[model samples]
Target: MKNSRFSEAQIMSILKQAEGGAPVSELCREHGMSSASFYKWRAKYGGMDASLISEMKDLAE
Candidate 1:
């Protein structure tokens, strides 16, 4: 699979920014990602912490 420019940790942090009351448009603009991409990430990674992401990676490996 192709890897994204931002890592899972980075994605989580970006999502956190949105949860912290940052506007989705500004977050996307700052991160150079589209609003659609942000929504996709939120759908996939929402409510998940970095440790859970690492665990999922370990399982995939």
Candidate 2:
């Protein structure tokens, strides 16, 4: 699998920003990522935290 440019913590921060009423378009522009990427991350990581992501990665290994 390809590695992501943003770390899990960064992804979580971005998602939290979106949930905090930040406009998706503005976030995408500010983050230099496309809306699709944001949505994909949301689908995969929504409701998950950094510790959970690390645990998942550890389990995957």
Candidate 3:
């Protein structure tokens, strides 16, 4: 069986990016992820820092 679970580190990293409040569309485009995946992660790990969750992204130039 392929253990297809996300690691804590991976989840946290995504959570961090999500917490940083990059536009959902932007995140989906930049990370090659989907809005559904983002929402799924958000539902699974719904305790990220709200303040950070509302802040702008710190994406690399």
Candidate 4:
């Protein structure tokens, strides 16, 4: 598996910001991440919390 620049928790928090009505473009800009990466993370980790992400990672491993 490839290592991500941002941790799962950070990804989840960024997703939460999007969920809470933050604009994706602005979030991406502020976070210095590309829109592609943000959407990719959202697609994979959209509704997942940190613990759930850890569980999924464990299962994948």
User: TM-score of every model?
Assistant: 0.92, 0.92, 0.56, 0.91
Q: Residue-wise lDDT of candidate 3 within 1-61, one digit each (tens)?
A: 5753555456667768767876778877876767887788778657855344434224311
Q: Can you tell me which runs of candidate 3 are displaced by over 4 Å?
A: 1-7, 48-61
Q: Locate the minimum summed-lDDT window of 10 residues in model 1.
A: 1-10
Worst 10 residues of 4 by lDDT: 1-10
RMSD of each: 0.8, 0.9, 10.8, 1.1
Which candidate number would show the highest lDDT if scored against the true structure?
Answer: 2
Candidate 3 residue pairs that clash: 19-53
Q: Candidate 3 at residue 24, lDDT?
A: 76
What TM-score does candidate 3 reach? 0.56
* Alpha-carbon deviation at 60 in model 2, angstroms: 1.2
C-alpha lDDT (0 to 100) for residue 2 of candidate 1: 81
RMSD of 1: 0.8
Model 4 ranges with Cα > 4 A deviation: none
TM-score of 2: 0.92
The collision pairs in model 2 are none
What C-alpha lDDT, on a 0 to 100 scale, does residue 61 get in candidate 3?
16
Give all candidates' CA lDDT scores: 0.93, 0.95, 0.66, 0.91
Q: What is the lDDT of residue 61 in candidate 4?
A: 84
Clash list (residue pairs), candidate 4:
none
